[model samples]
Target: MEIQYLGHSAFKIKINNTLLITDPFLSDDPDLGIKFPKIEARIVTVSHNHHDHNGVAAVSGNPFIIRTPGEYEVSGINIFGYATFHDEKEGKERGRNTIYLIEGEKMNVCHLGDLGHVLENELVEMLGEVDVLLIPVGGTYTLDAVKATEVVRQIEPKIVIPMHYFHPKFKFKLNPVENFVKEMGVGVPEKTDKLKLSKDKLPQETKLVIMEAS
Candidate 1:
């Protein structure tokens, strides 16, 4: 399986012939001075109803869309959406959020869409095994660097990819990725364009990967 980051919280994942995209934030924003590239996917998953995280219409190919908590199978990929909150106040602050676990090619790629609070023990057990984690490290609307690092410890994924943080082009009041890197006590790794992984060759210890938006 291969994963490509598309600025902010959007990501495109390719598993064999199937294409999957999460939180398609494709609209051009003057504040950010950025535009998403044209991409097609068989499946799209939105964590919440936020405009920034739910741009399904921008994606082509008439993809199957999942936005709620449920179990679904698309193109032989098993997807489980777990109910989560967008804020620590139990949705009083932001609203409900969905954390999706995409299972394909014998690996589990978990995307925490705008997750605002840390996971409880039960929620972590529900996620089971996560090979790759796509998480939001930006503070204001989601988990900050410290909390994000805490969550990473909870999930204990082999590959950790931080997202939704501050970028010069993002124009959001959020913490920088450097904060998270610091909390993890590791020097920043060189940013890569994409991440390719196979179950057999996954790292034995947790690894932090910084990805350049494609």
Candidate 2:
């Protein structure tokens, strides 16, 4: 399987013969100055209606789209979306966020889009075992560095990928990824433009792998 980060909560994933994308961010996030590549995905998912996470139009091809919590199967891949909040106020402030768990090729990849709070015991139990975790570590709109560290501990994924945090190209007010790294007591993680992972390569313990936006 191959994973590429498209900046600001967006990722393009390739598993087996299937291609999918998560949280297609708008090309022009005046703040982020992000110009995503022209992508054509067989399946697209929007974590919520937010402009930064719901750029379904940016994706080419009439892709199968998922936007709510449910069980779905498409292109030989299985997906499960769970209801989550974008703010601690329970949507009173920032509306709902959806955390997606994708299963395929003997791996489970979980993408937490703008998750605002820690998971309850039930949600944590439902997550089960995650091979790769995409989490938000930037504060303000999502979990801050400290909270994200907490979430990592709760889920205990084999590979952890931090997203939605500060980057040179990002034009938002948020804490830098370095803050999260510090909180984790791990030094700066190795940066890769893409990750080609398999069940055999999964680390025995949690590993932080940062992907440079390509």
TM-score of each: 0.97, 0.97
**Runs in model 1 lying further than 4 Å from the true structure:** none
Per-residue accuracy of model 2 over 36-81 as CA lDDT, tens digit each = 8898889998899987888888899899999999999998899999
lDDT of each: 0.91, 0.92
RMSD of 2: 1.0
lDDT of 1 at 26: 54
Global CA lDDT of candidate 1, please?
0.91
Candidate 1: lDDT of 118?
98
